[model samples]
Target: MTYLEKWFDFNRRQKEIESLLEETIAQQSEQSLTLKEFYLLYYLDLAQEKSLRQIDLPDKLHLSPSAVSRMVARLEAKKLWST
Candidate 1:
């Protein structure tokens, strides 16, 4: 109930949730996608037309533009996603 205790509790829960999500994503996607990639696809699926500008992905996925571009390229290479 103290501030430090609350902070630690919050961190613990966050880690647990993140771990669970990673496990679920791995199982469901058959390890074909990383958590970030899964999130990218999820964001695109939620877009108005299932598309978003390359520049917009950095903010959505909290990655640098270059990182987003690289990830997109990898997905495209794998034939799993495209612009």
Candidate 2:
């Protein structure tokens, strides 16, 4: 396959995977968190210190601090866990 074809295929597969993950999260989690929230949890899980700060999340997830704060707020609103 050519470069263009490869890029298109990769994008297609990424979208499909994203869709499947959304579906799985909806089915599995009672809280029904967004993909960003899941990534935040996963990143926190990987941290050696296990101490998550709002400032640290932006660097870990490549999101703005405000965006990370919003995700944390959403999760807290659901009462999923403390920040």
- How many Å off is the CA of 62 in candidate 1? 1.4
Measured with C-alpha atoms, the lDDT of residue 35 in candidate 2 is: 77
User: Where is model 1 poorest over a 10-residue stretch in terms of lDDT?
Assistant: 26-35
What is the per-residue lDDT of model 1 for residues 5-70, given as tens digits with 9 covering 90 to 100?
999999999989878888888787744777888888888889897878888899888999999999
Error of 1 at 30 (Å): 3.8
Off by over 4 Å in 2: none
How displaced is residue 70 in candidate 2, in Å? Answer: 0.8
lDDT, candidate 2, at 36: 75
lDDT of candidate 1? 0.86
lDDT tens digits by residue: candidate 2, 11-40: 999999988998898899987877778888
